[model samples]
Target: MILHIDMDAFYASIEQRDHPEYRGKPVIVGGGNGRGVVSAASYEAREYGVHSAMPGRRAGQLCPHGIFVKGRHSHYAAVGRQVREIFSRYTPLVQPLSLDEAFLDVSGTLRLFGDAETIGRRIKAEIAEELELPASVGVAPRKFIAKIASDIDKPNGFVVVREDEIHSFLDPLPVERVWGVGKVGARRLHQLGFRTIADIRRYDESLLKSKLGAWGAHLWRLANGIDEREVIPDRNAKQISHERTFSEDQSDFEFLHSVVCFLCEQTAMRLRRHGRKAKSVGLKYRREDFRTFSKSKVLETPTDETAVIIRVATELLATMRQTEPRPVRLIGVSLSALVGADAPTQMSLFDDPGYVQAERRVDRVMDQLADRLGDSRIYRAGSHDWRKRPRE
Candidate 1:
């Protein structure tokens, strides 16, 4: 069986656990300023309609007494490692979706560990006992259903869907419950008189394919509980990327540029940590209407330098902007075509050795400072100011 485990309010819960006085109070992480977006919200704060990715200004209006805290990405990453270690104890066939959630296939270990339900319960209990954090778990024969089951009842929820109970469990749920069905996609589905998963299941697959192209057929299959995806373990890292969806659509050139710069910085940090360099860098742009575009640049030299990546990324972004200066809802940066850091460099004789060495030294120092303090404490100048400024 497949098991999906997700931490409950990971960032805010960590803040509350570390700060004794903040327990049971409304706690919101990130969104320290008007322009900032919330990273996470505790259940206490969620009662007032606060949530992640909501604009800080709106969150403040909703939860007037909400306690706002800056996010410490480095600290959170450390805690996430501990959580994964607990998962590793149970099974090696584990796949992490993010820092706060993962999937584990226990088919091999079921004979030794008991059924999927028992293993899920024990893992959940271990996390609570060891980390003092709440986790919701879901077990099913398929990946999509398992993920959906985990989220059905959150904040310490546990759900199990037997092979025979998949349809009964999924039928009544809203169309949005299906993965990749965002607000825009949901609205489109609803407009077509499809309000629930069952509605999609009852529709003609050929018609769906004709109307929505490949996505329609994809949704139809998922609605019928036909997901065949496996839990893929990240044993060998292939690509590194980071993306952000804003609380509101952003159009300002400078703000969006800063966002790219920040993402490139994060992507580069991971690349260096993995002892890798990239031969290609790419950018993903999603408009407010949910249309997406991508651009990539091939580099002559593979280097894990934030400056080089962002320079290539900005040029790509400018080209995309020229094509269509539409409001953006999401932006991302990625580095691929990875090679080991020890790989020989193909540098021109005119290339300055002094400058290259200086850049590497700077990256090492920044990474060290980030580890010693937190990612929130250290950042390049290009990304510092716009994160907190109100959109004009």
Candidate 2:
């Protein structure tokens, strides 16, 4: 059996939990800038048609009186860790889809835990007691049905699908409910008279393959609940990146450099938090016209040092300056080729030992300070004095 647990309005819930006055009211969590999109919407705000991915301005229009809070990602991550710890007690097979949702295979433990329904109830109860937040759980024989079932009764609800009920439960669901159906897929399915899972299941397999290519054949299997993906553990990330879209495009080099330093610091903090190091550093820039450019350099050794990343990113920016200087819209820093910190280091003879040692010491001090205080409590020196220019 598989159990799917999804936290209800995770980011907004955290905001409400931290601020008692925000309870029982519409809340949106995201950047306060006009260019920002809604990252999470509370159930109250969702009633007003506010949702994630909606433009922040549009969300404000939807709920004029809604409380908009700037996002605190570190807080959300802390809550996510607490949730993951709770899930770990039930089973070690937890596969987190994101910070707020995960899948757990509990087939072997059914006998020990009574039944799948009881397990779901216990998980929900544990989350509520430990975190003071509500969650929805779904239990089924397969991951596909379990994931969908979890969403059926959201906000502190549970649903259990018996083996015999899978077909009937899926039959009436819209094609969009299937795993791979996005707006494009839904439109195509609509044109093919396949409005529901049942319709797709009844369609000729060859015709589906011919019409939708490989995706159609894949969807045919999913419509019949034939997913075989396992509840994978240890889904270690391959890269860590941080990007910020400015509220207004500008040609200010000092301000853009400060932002790049801030992004590099954020990326390095994440790498240290995960006890990982990167072998490559990269920078991304978006011009006012939305044309994006990126440059990367392979480091002589893996590192999780902010200064080193910033130095390389600054070098990349110098190269970019050789071309026309258009107003900057966005800046990003990324670290890839990740490996565990405990892994052996392969350093070249030409590498500067003094610089490497200084970077390591700086990283350790920064990491300690961040762990004791908070990520935002400390930032790059240049970023501390950055001032946004007024719109023209």
Candidate 3:
């Protein structure tokens, strides 16, 4: 059986767990102003129409009593490690999709663990008892169904879909419950008289395929409870990134430049944190009209250096202006073509021999300082103050 484990409102839940005053209150983790967007909102806030990715001002209007807090990504990373350690105890075939969610293939471990549902209960119990965190577990025979089942009932839910019951369990569920059926897809499916998975199952797959293209056949199989995807372990990331959406469009190049620097630093930090380096830097920006542009540059050497990342990202953003001056609603940086930190580099003979070493030292110091102090608390304004030695 496959097991999917998803934490309940991970960021906001962490905030509530750390701060006693935030418990039962609508906790929001992000800036609650026009300059920011919501990162996560507690279940309490969801009742008031607040959600992640929503504008902070709208979240505030929806839940006026919301308790807004800055996200401590370091804390979240630490907790994620703890959660991962718990998953490791059960099975080695674990694939983490994010810090708060993962898929575990327990087919081999079932013999030692009794059964799939038993293992799921034990795992959920351990998380709640040991870490005081609520986790929803879904155990099924397929990967996609397991993910969907885990989310079916959340915030301390456990659901087991037996092999014999997969069809019945899926039949009456709305067509929207199928993965990849977003707003537009759902509306189209509804217009085709597909209110439920059963309706989809009744339709001819070829007819549906002709109408929806290749995706229609995929949806038809899903409706009939057929998912062949495996839970492959060690699905290491191909890239690391960070992005931000503004409450209001930002037109100023100076301001956008600062945002790019911040995003580069954030992405580079994450790259290093994983003991990886990127050989390519990618930039993405969405205009006020919702049009998006993306560009990337491959580097001569893989690096997790903040300076190099920022320089390349800034250059990519500058290329967008050639089209026309446009206000940006969102901006992001991505680091790809990841390689191990120990990967050998052929440093330029023309460049200083100590250049790479100096850059690593600076990034290490900054990483430590950011962990000790908040990420936003420190900034490099063209100075070496961070390199100064303390009293002996």
Candidate 4:
């Protein structure tokens, strides 16, 4: 069976776990700025309509007494590593969806671990006991149902769906319960008198296809509890990126440019950490009105160089700013189309032959420093003014 594990309000939970006084209080983790968005909120905060991705300004209005905290990505990454280690002890076939959620294929380990339900319960208890973190576990014969089952109870939930009971468990649920059926899909399904999965299952395949296009058949089958997907052991990352939201809208080009340089360096360093390089660089920005857009440029060669990524990102930012010259609330940089860091470098006549080697040596030293003192402790020359000042 496939077991899906989701850590409850992971970032907020971590904050509460680390700080005993924060427990049972409405706690939030994110940018800690008026313009910032909530990355995660504790269950207490959720009762007041505060949630992840909500505006920090709104979160405060909803839960005025809530404790807001800045996210410590380095600390969270360390805890995530520990969580992965716990999963490894149970099964090698584990796929991490994020720092807080994963899928474990226990089909082969039943003899060693008992039934799927037993394994799921044991994992939930183990994570809670060993790490002092609550986890929800969902077990099913297929990946999709298991994922859905995990969130049903939530905050230290364990749900098991045997093969024959899949339909009963899913039929009465809303179409939105299906993973791929988002707001748009759910609206369309509702329009078709398909409020429930059971209602969706009653539709003819041809009619579903005619109404919903290519995804119709897939949705219909999923509604009827037919998911033929396997639990893959790895969640491959396609891009590396970083962004920061400001406490106030920023229209100044020079200051935003400096932020872009810092974001580029951070992303490039992360790419190098994975022994990867990116062939394309992109920029994203959100206006105070919340409208966001992005643009990208393909490079002639893959690179993990901060200067190259920043240059491309700055060019893209200029293009975006020209189209929408509003005060920006947030800015981000991303690198995609990745290759190995050791991918062949095509030397150009304009380049000094020793330059690439020199950059690598510098990166090696920086990596060591970052490993010992965290990424925020070090910065490039261009990424100044940010260390001491908050986004506002």
Q: Worst 10-residue stretch by lDDT in candidate 2?
A: 383-392
Model 2: per-residue lDDT, tens digit, 102-171?
9988877878887878888998998888788989999988888898899888887789889899889999
Backbone clashes for every candidate come to 0, 0, 0, 0
Q: Which residue pairs collide in model 3, if any? A: none
TM per model? 0.83, 0.67, 0.70, 0.70
**lDDT, candidate 3, 333-382, per-residue tens:** 99999899998776767767687689879899989877754465565652
RMSD from true fold, candidate 3:
7.6
Q: Candidates 2 and 3: which is better by lDDT?
A: 3
List, residue by residue over 134-248, the lDDT tens digit for candidate 1.
9999999999999999999999999999999999998999999998777667877888899999999989999988877767888999999999888877545567889877757
Q: Which 10-residue window in model 4 sums to the lowest lDDT?
A: 383-392
Tell me the alpha-carbon RMSD of every candidate: 3.5, 7.6, 7.6, 7.0
Instruction: Return the clash pairs for model 2, or none.
Output: none
Please identify which of the two predictions, 1 or 2, would achieve the higher TM-score against the true structure. 1
lDDT of model 4 at residue 317? 80
lDDT of each: 0.87, 0.81, 0.82, 0.82
Model 3: which ten-residue window has the lowest total lDDT? 383-392
TM-score for predicted model 4 compared with the true structure: 0.70
